[model samples]
Target: MPEPDEICGVNIAFAVVGSKWKPTILWVLAGRPHRFAELRRAVGGISEKVLAAQLRELERDGVVCREAGAGFPLNVRYSLTPAGVTLDRLLEPLAEWGHQLQRGR
Candidate 1:
């Protein structure tokens, strides 16, 4: 993989949000903070382990924020950081293109 600084701007963007699960995770979290189970349901077909791993990666990338409360059953939630919000905006055009393709327009 090319170092982010070595790549063009587009490639750098892809490097951050290119994964199959990462975009979905970001999109869902863009709506509002959600618990782990809510994210799993919103992003259907993702397994618990995979979701956990992806969330960890996103957190490391500074695009996702993970919060947990101190309680009997831990209440964990995920939300987009300001950087993640910017990424969500950047991806909007690509999403529109996908919609057009789906519509055959």
Candidate 2:
């Protein structure tokens, strides 16, 4: 069931992961958990401010999880939530499609 404002499942999904960096972020996180710095490096070309903002958004949407280790340095790690893992799996076809498109061009 969907609300009137939602329109459809596609729109709902896009609303959650439609940003330029969101898919790439999810793709990187799919490999394994990463610290903030590691994620920033893995998802290159994105500014710190943008990465932070996108991560926060993903976390808020329940697609990502942030865990803080108990230590003086306060290590923080980011990983895909169950929902995010499912989303990442769903994106595989899209990724393959993109590769095909790139090869065609």
Candidate 3:
């Protein structure tokens, strides 16, 4: 049901974070933890449904941590896990490369 190329390490990594929104979500989480609404605003242009879905997938992949505060309003915060921090570090060079390309360098 999957292509041979999809079984490799690189592909496996991509499978976890291959979506357009995942990287942006991770980028925001990399800074600090954010409540669900705060995260939605920070990630801008992504629908609530999509953000919810992405966060769920990231949580399932062990890249994001969702903690619910014990309060009446139900404050839910999202942050990156250790593995996510490492992944974010790896993405830094790639982001730099993207910037370079954008600047026509």
Task: Please list the Cα RMSD from the true structure of every candidate, rounded to 1 decimal place.
Answer: 3.7, 2.9, 4.2
Models 1 onward score TM values of: 0.84, 0.87, 0.87
Which one is best on lDDT? 2
Number of the candidate with higher lDDT, 1 or 2: 2
Clashes of each: 0, 0, 0
lDDT of 3 by residue, 67-104 (tens): 99898888889999999999989888988999999999
Cα error, candidate 1, residue 65 (Å): 0.3
lDDT, candidate 3, at 26: 93
Give me the displacement of residue 32 in model 3, in angstroms: 0.6
Clashing pairs in 2: none
Best by TM-score: 2
| Candidate 3 accuracy as lDDT | 0.92
State candidate 1's TM-score: 0.84
- The list of candidate 1 runs beyond 4 A from truth reads 1-7
Tens digits of per-residue lDDT for model 1, 11-86 = 7678778999998999999999999998999999999999999999899889999999899788988999999999
CA lDDT, candidate 3, residue 43 = 94
Residue 7, model 3: lDDT of 67
